[model samples]
Target: MSGGLARCSGSPDRDPGLQPERTRLAWRRTTLAVTVASVLAVRTALHGRAGSGELPAVACAILAWLGFVVVAHQRIRALSTPRPPLLTHRAALLTAICAALVAACGAALVG
Candidate 1:
């Protein structure tokens, strides 16, 4: 039966159960995509062999997109769960790590 049909069944509404497995899967997908984007960002940023080059705005954009994905994944997870945010504090650290990696690449360009 469809989810709406199930809800209409005359049964007592227990609770809107969070689909943990699906949430986790979404996180996994987001992480995987971000990882790939990060690699591409690094490669693009390092493309010029020597001398100053234009800032790789593409990489910056990718990084920002990754951050959005992280936020989106977290939001979905929070909505699925009834308790306090399961990812509570990890989001900041994760974003920091990703940002640090991108920064390191940029620094290498300046070196």
Candidate 2:
């Protein structure tokens, strides 16, 4: 019990604070939002008569969804350890970029 895993008392129960569970739930929510946006973008693109003009927006949405999936995977993996690592700045930046892209796509579809 001298290693990193020893941080816990082996009670077979999660911490009372439930930090890891909360973090994982938050990540799932984010992924769900991105997925919904991507689906909306694809639906809009399909309904429009712009042909290939809307493809870029759809592509951006797809990429954003994929990016979120990657982030979530990393987050879950990190949470599996006895001592969870802090969220990476790079992941935050990527999430922001993806959100912006999705917003822009929605705006473009509107106007």
TM-score of each: 0.40, 0.80
How would you encode candidate 1's per-residue C-alpha lDDT over 4-71 as one tens digit per residue? 33433334542445354355556667667666766666666667565554365545646665775767
Off by over 4 Å in 1: 1-18, 49-53, 56-59, 62-66, 76-111
How many pairs of residues collide in model 1? 0
Name the top lDDT candidate: 2
Query: Which number leads on TM-score?
Result: 2
- What is residue 62's positional error in candidate 2, in angstroms? 0.6
What is the alpha-carbon lDDT of model 2 when measured against the actual structure?
0.75
The regions of model 2 sitting more than 4 angstroms off are: 1-14
lDDT of 2 by residue, 1-111 (tens): 133234434546647676766676788788888889889888888887776568777887888778878977788767755557888899889888888888888777766
Error of 1 at 38 (Å): 2.4
